[model samples]
Target chain A: MIDSGIRLPWNRRLKLLIAYDGSSFSGWQRQKHDRTIQGEIEKCLSIMTNEDIFLHGAGRTDGGVHAEGMVAHFDCSSRIPDQNFMRGLNSMLPGAIRILDTNTCDPSFHARFSAIGKKYHYTVFTGKVHPPRIRLYSHHVTAPLNLATINSCLQAVVGTHDFSSFENSGSRDKSLTGGRGAVRTIYSARLLQQDKDCLVFEFIGDGFLKNMVRNLVGTILEAGRGKFDAEQFAAILAAKDRSSGGPTAPPQGLFLKQVFYQDRTLDHCISGKD
Target chain B: MIDSGIRLPWNRRLKLLIAYDGSSFSGWQRQKHDRTIQGEIEKCLSIMTNEDIFLHGAGRTDGGVHAEGMVAHFDCSSRIPDQNFMRGLNSMLPGAIRILDTNTCDPSFHARFSAIGKKYHYTVFTGKVHPPRIRLYSHHVTAPLNLATINSCLQAVVGTHDFSSFENSGSRDKSLTGGRGAVRTIYSARLLQQDKDCLVFEFIGDGFLKNMVRNLVGTILEAGRGKFDAEQFAAILAAKDRSSGGPTAPPQGLFLKQVFYQDRTLDHCISGKD
Candidate 1:
């Protein structure tokens, strides 16, 4: 008995490119009380569509961690045009969060599962006095860092290895359930001089465990400051024990730059214009 | 007949290079009821030295206007070292303002009167949607602008001219007191592409009348949008009437980059690293 009048549910998968300051957000995850990126977006989308919409983000960035090109997606029953969805969502969202772009994507395009790799940047301002203008965007390190040492240490970080030492304990249980161990492939790692006093550390990898990027930056900074040598850093990585690594760097200095997918089509969709 | 014990005062003039996020400040001038850059600095200095300290800024930036290298000077009778002055002021001042560098300068060094030239930059974000991260630092213009047209129009603005048309009414009274007319020399004017969607208008001139930079940016943006041809823009300048010019642009996009002094010794004081 086919109910012909029960019109087939019209569903569309919408992908969004989002950017947020993260200074005011608890994180990307939705929480009942805390203000979060995902919570804010979902609340706005639900009001706009009159349906409870859940957002799936590529990465769950921690509090005080910013994003320039975070990817997310959701299924919507409403037939809102792509451009209108972007404009509507942005208008409803707070000034701290923004939907940079919106597009219709294949149903199978999952923001998290389909992601192949991700890139992150950590900025450090080594000026004598931290400039007030960039205080939120960068970490202030009054001590000058040796760039040559930092670059040399990065060379050792650019390869497949078990990054358990770099992962915080909170994410260990989740990694264990996957049964793939803590081994992850790092495609590249490099140190960039943003200006005379700002140093940027960029990492591109297959995946990152919670606090992995921050921990790596902290450890690398130690080597840059001659607190430890590259050999000692390599030894810490081989230990695979969190206690063997340096302290996790502050969250404010970290930024999730972009998430990459295997589909070449999605690459072009990520606006290279910005 | 001076008391021998009351030695002649050794007042040291200290120059400070400051940077501030103007979002929270009323302006650079000292106001009785409003929070301002000068007022904040004076309060902090008064607390530190128990003496009334007055700061003379290189430019009296309007509300919501930012500065990267604003120079200011104050006479200090307390024998505090230059480094200690910087550290003490920063420790007491709010996080929104910071002293980038501090040095003892010649007593004749006046932040305003000693300046021979100044540079200001106005940033416009021409992206489809303004990224929330840079909203306070740049003006968001959704429509695409023709850079070539803007550059061509800038050619007409490079030389010295009577900028009366671009001066706002609030500043007209001050300009009239000079009796030299509204004639001012513009050393250079150019359009710079900061990134894919960020256009930066850089203006280097002997001095700028109040609201002159904002008005010029407004008129130049109109020319970029093809609202008025280059010849019309030239005529607007020739008209020497405020009503003939475009509306004054908003204050958020304006930044006082540097103030140059004619003295070769002071010239070296400007940080060229940035």
Candidate 2:
């Protein structure tokens, strides 16, 4: 009943690393009345390949969120050459969405399901006045912050814990299965480059709930602004409630910087197209 | 009668150094119904200041012709603070159109009439393939050519001449104000930095007729391809007819790099803005 070795329907699946400056989009997912990057890609793919090609993302990012190494997967029956796919798909996509790399997978490699650990980088430009060039890509923080204080707070949120304190209250569980609660294992959380204008916070984890990274960023930002210290941050995480969390940060600074997988079984032919 | 000293018009004329990426726009000038950079800027200004703003440009750039330092002038009766006018006008403008610098000028300082010389840069990517990152800003040429040969031919068209051969035969003759073709002076037209992938041609002259730079670029591109040798280029200039010109290159590669003003009127205010 498992059908592990049944080569009868061994279809082809493509894994892709897509980057987008999502300023003019509604989000990664398909919406009822708004334009989404996924919807655009799906529509363009269906037209170009003459098939109903649905796109699956590693995770859906909110509006205004940018990505440099965002991952996604889709199955297709067309016999298009892999070397030309990157050019073709990119030609269809607008200037904002860029297909950085692509590869053929074992048809079972779902971008979300097969992931082991994911890493996200949030960039914030901390200055009294933000420069014009980096305003689009980074969060402009006018408040004065100390790096040592923020790092101390970030260290307490790294390990395994029930992350109810960091979940977005407005976000709903969108899976077919109902009443899901998050108990994700956060491998590491460190505020990297705390001493620079372009501040980066990298979070490596097995899996993440909705808006988890952004919420964590919000918490760290509060700690940086001296609203709460490291011990207070730990106590808030121990509360196990959304009300105990800090304010959710804006999506503009959060990036799906890199997506991790159990097996990066990608071919050169597909990746070479870029 | 010129209103002098005692009575002055309430509206003041301001000069603006505008920069734009032309890929998303129709052209510099406004069309009947289509979208153009000039039209968008004027529309935004009209909306912001509650006045009908008209844009008078130094030169007319065709569709897909970008500019780094294009010049334009406008008069506004609104009580525009010197500091706020530059910022407010740009804040209302689209993201692509940036007011690089601003200056208040004499009422009679027409953007087109007061111009001394214009410097345009034509960028060509000469390699086996075009670079994806810079594809929008440059032209792609696959055939390899000798740099020394191309550089030698450029030395011939440096000085003053009747560049009818480098003007489009069928292009508009608006420069023939009184039925005489423009006999403008060409200070320099040289090709610099000719290596593996990039060739930049810098043209500085008193003025340029319609499609003159494109025609010049086409002529040089042909010479670089070994079709038009040095002697043929000299003959083309001597012919004093547009039919003698070579192919007209695409408009994407050309950028209005800078418009040089003889006086130091702009540098003072530009320094303050910076």
Candidate 3:
């Protein structure tokens, strides 16, 4: 402590708030051959810091799934200012991905492990003619839907329950305590009318299984179309079997809107309501 | 008294409300060697009707300029219903363009000549880190700007005035009664704070010269940055010289929002505020 001249490792941990269109990305993971959100960001960080860097995202969004407030963390030894990270990464990243904000964080702040909650949004275009400008960001449903029916179906999705029926087969592990980890808590499920032609479904949950949001939306949509009555929807959830749920909706309409942490200092990054 | 059996050439004039993300288009006009909005639509119509079709758009948006409600008209002898045109054209056209609505119009109706007014929108992203998802639709301006100063500049842009200083030199015509035709009426000009980081400039006018809206935004931005005072901006407008105005803003931030026609029947097309 007396020798102030001695140099110390920067040993700084950085957090990043990222946004992407997801039209061209394969997914959020780092794949050897496929283009991905994590792969792209790591490449840019490597170039900027001149060192191999690795990133851990809050969630692994599938291909064609967008994110507005996806949180990530990386450890770096570079002595550059925090602002430079934002500028340098954005300058090197593709036009489809952006570093919305950057900040230095506590070394113990893990992107995935310390996360407390997540919010997902799915958009459905209910217009007669879907606009080309938003085709990649919304699911076009030309069939008229009964909103009241869909809202009732959503009520059956909230609360702590076994959501095995909503999980995709590929993500299931029967060996994990006999599939006891399939339980998750949903705090709120809302259907917001963004405009005359757009309906946004928002789900805030303590956790989500693979393909859970899309499958839930698919089940609710079927109810809206009058294919399944309210009683049948409850029965599907109670079955706890994958075959009991509807088909998974397309991935293009799904978005990881926000990742919540315990500190809540990063809440400013989540701007604007859907 | 008319003969219903014989079709009088079917001489039906149809008007279409189109929306497009112009990132992939060369412009609204048809160029022999470029992909354009008009060229793509006309080609689709030709394939569907098996006839050479010509289209007239309300405005010729430059390359990279988007449109939310651009209007166009075409004449066809095909006896298909109006709904078919909307479905057929959309099915054949590329994903960047969409036909929102289609209807048969009076033979006297024209897309450009009959337009009584037009509205254009320019978006400027004032955030420190520009979101890549909106890079093609907004201009990135990181400099802090004064909203009061910009609003004062915009106040001077409204009302009738000679806009020669705002027009691009290539679009100017000195032979039109010694450039007297440059005088046009601006109905309203508004600077909207879309969010904490986005500023939208909306211009409504009876007519606008080429590059007028972009140039006006450029000038207003300069004033917002304290580059010029409100007096200097008013002086620039009065100068009536192209060199007196600020540089023309980039085309990517520009949008043809809507076109107003004298027939109140078309008023329904312009719904919702900016």
**Winner by DockQ:** 3
Off by over 4 Å in 3: A1-9, A172-179, A263-274, B1-9, B172-180, B263-274
Candidate 3 pairs with clashing backbones = none
lDDT of candidate 3 over A1-274, digit per residue (tens): 5876744358989999999989888989899999999999999898888888999898889999999999999988997778889988888888789888898889999998788789899999998877766878899888889998898888888899999889897774457333557898887788879999899998988788999999999988988898988789989999999898998889889989889885353333332332
Tens-place lDDT per residue, model 3, B39-66, is 9999999888788999989878889999
lDDT of 2: 0.76
lDDT of 2 by residue, A88-126 (tens): 887788867878777777787988777666778888888
Higher-lDDT candidate of 1 and 3: 3
In terms of docking quality, how is candidate 3 classified? medium
What TM-score do all the candidates reach, one by one? 0.88, 0.67, 0.90
- Which residue pairs in candidate 2 collide? none
TM-score of predicted model 2? 0.67
Write the candidate numbers in order of decreasing TM-score: 3, 1, 2
Among these predicted structures, which one has the highest lDDT? 3
lDDT of 3: 0.86
